[model samples]
Target: MTTRSCLLPPSIIRPGGRPLLSTGRAAARAALIALSGLLWVGALATPPPSSLRGADAACVNCHRRSGLGSIEGHIAIPPIAGPYLFVPRGERLAELGIPFVDTARINHDPYTDESLARAIRGGIGANGKTLNYLMPRYQIDDATMAELIGYLKGLRVSPSPGVSTSVLHFATIITPDADPVKRRGMLAVMNQYFVDKNNAVARTKAPTLYSSHTTMFRVERRWQLHVWELTGAPATWEAQLRKHLAAEPVFAVISGLGGSHWGPVQRFCEEQSLPCLFPNVEAPTGHDSDFYSVYFSRGVLLEAQLIARELADAAEPANRVVQVFRAGDVGVQAARDLQAARAHSGQQIVNRVLPAHATSKDLGAALRDVDAADALVLWLRPGDLSALEKVSPPTSRVWISGEMGGLEQAPLPASWRAAARMAYPVDLPGRRVVRVDYALSWFRIRKIPLLAQQVQADTYLACGLVSETLNHMVDAFVREYLIERVEMALDHRALTGYYPRLTLAPGQRFASKGGYIVRFSDPQGPRIAALGDWITP
Candidate 1:
């Protein structure tokens, strides 16, 4: 039941109504199929062409996981889902409840099972014309062709959950342990953004015709945001999110807030196939293998790598590394990450874990034995940093977590400021003014108080990005499609608040990849200077 390429010349089409596929010809055909980005039916045992990577994902890459197909430059990859393929000519897709997709071809004749098989076996279409060059011909067996057609027929055509004719519902998750001030700021931005989005749309719920596409009509759907606040321990957070989603079904989760433990929420999103976009978390937990949970950056985990890179490329080699952080905080993970990064460097790495409710005395005890030869790393909060005034830095080679300690505004006392270099994950303050000002202007107009500048700006950026992606999507409200569109749309963003640049591709979840290592310029205030250029560790 293995699939074979139907890219043979006319002389070699069939000797006796069967494909004459030799080893070299089969390999050559695989290359052509790979290049054409065609769907292969029942090729589970077939070895992919050596030069092409992700051969099995060819169809998904072109037609998309939603089967809604994408438009690349001038090329239109038409939707292949059952409704678009099998619907009789002149029947409005809206009448059949199929959401309008820009790439759908409504004028084409309907595809019968036999005609569809013919299209697959040759480069012909249901209308007796040749298909697009992007579509590769496949010589699939009758049984496998039937299975593939069945699979296409089962592809979801209706609008995703939380989508109505005139309103689209979205949710934002807030963990109980999240910072109250930051949560308030993020919510203010999200609420205001949603309000502005809906207000800009016409009051009437009339459906307007899509551009140049007569069969499909676009309805202006108002955006609605639901705030899902999770309570209790991290273990219970997932269940709470599930309950919230059940009560208020949403197409996607956007611009949420989390504290040290976003793992539960991240897992819940992945398991449910929900798009959790750019959540603000001190420490984001997940692997590149994950699909649904995307973040602006890796958070403190990225800072650890930045610090590690510094340590590796330092002019003076350190005899030992001393890391300090409070227990049960995101710094715990950051410390571990740095330790892992320095594993093969043959340096002595010591971790000083303070009590959850530690005091100045506890901080003093942690830095008790550090000396000039040692490289000290602090993964502490503002309170812990302020207390450092009492305990002078034990080493000149000191690295601090700008994220946990409050970026350029970290309250490292004057004595420690001169000695410590901060791992600033976001764009340098001086460089990002114009980009950040856009969000700040929106806040000022809406009269939303600027409590947490970075958090609010990031939330606004997330909302803008989602809105832009949706605009490109037109009326297709598929969750997978939303995520895919976000990945594609991120690179085109000119206003990436707090970040120098943001980009994402398939399997690349983190949008902003690198940061600058900075040192405080003055003893007090938020003034800072970059020690060097941005480093992507």
Candidate 2:
């Protein structure tokens, strides 16, 4: 055994062969050091390559391994790759133009990194136009921006296997300054009805030819009174609308008609002989015609009945019913519901109408008058609900209930937690089928504090219903509109989930009906409830 000197460099031993520090070896060593330095400099100067920085990587954390596909959920951000690449690059981008670019043509090329940067940062498109009002302007630094761009560029555009590229376009004409809540409500309802992603047909500050094209396409058009806020006089809105009509023929209009400006839009639709669907607006008794309105007046009455029924059901069967409502339309509706309940349920029903601006003390005094019934049904706006909740007794036994609109616009104040139950219509974030898997997954994964709350459970229920209903509606619509294609895409079992197989009929509107009974169980405690399909008893 020969003892090897550990201290000696390998170069001395290898000198007879390929020397460690030979001329070629020295050149290679120098090259390696220089390359390492260059790489370090590049890393520092250029910012880590966006792929390494990880914004898109973070996105994939939720969107999943295949960038183009997603797990089912209502708020599930759709895959950005695959066939729907048109969504981000074509549709959403075109709809939300590039700020300052103003190419005049729609979806002109060069939807580059800079254009996307403007959209994410300034909420402006490359075309110098503001984007869809809903897109939140995220605060992204240059490094993150580079990363996002790199990630987007890396995305493959090949359509996902088994996915189709065809998209159904449903247009809605909405006012430039539409009420956010109402607009959201409308979108929520349509989402439930059509089971389609909400897409804007066209947006305009003035009623322009662009709007006319949208209307002719029978897009859900939203007309509002605030157009006056833009032009001082309502006439400017009319003029713009006329210009749009001249360019594009319109079919019918869906009147969200409210305030003063409704008259013009309504008149335009009427002149065009196009049908208008107005929610809750009634037609003349015994007269049937093409134009229809679902008036708000009926909504008030239906809501009142809904509240009365819910209160009666929740209370002890023997408890008498008393309704506290404001004077005018709301008061009358409450009175009718009480009368109907008295006739049907045989429970004693009483009505108390307050002045237009009734105070807390007044409501408290009226509330005290009722002895036989501990349960009270309020038919008032959110402000009134807030006031009443404050004044009412805070005990679990003393239950107060009302309709969806009865609760204040904001979250229930701390003090009123245990004292009230309010009816709420299902909406996107609240109640929809798409949320079920997501909520369950979130609860299972992070154990988020908010998810631990009982209110979140109620929200989960609402979301379930929304998803179920939308799935049902879309399935039906597709069966009627594109039967062959839908049947080809899904199996019979999948179709059953969307539409009841027993009642498969073309062009039939499947009513996806549901409501929630949200009650505060304790003050500063937790809100709890049961929600399901709203079935009339």
Model 1 bad stretches (over 4 Å)? 1-57, 127-139, 202-211, 214-216
**Model 2 TM-score on a 0 to 1 scale:** 0.37
List, residue by residue over 145-200, the lDDT tens digit for candidate 1: 66567656655766778888788999999998899999999999999998898888
lDDT of each: 0.81, 0.38
Q: 261-309 in candidate 2: lDDT tens per residue?
A: 3444444443432323332111111112112211112233444555666
Residue runs of model 2 more than 4 Å from their true location after superposition? 1-249, 255-274, 277-305, 311-315, 328-335, 372-374, 394-416, 427-510, 521-527, 531-537
Candidate that scores best on lDDT: 1
Q: Best by TM-score, which number? A: 1
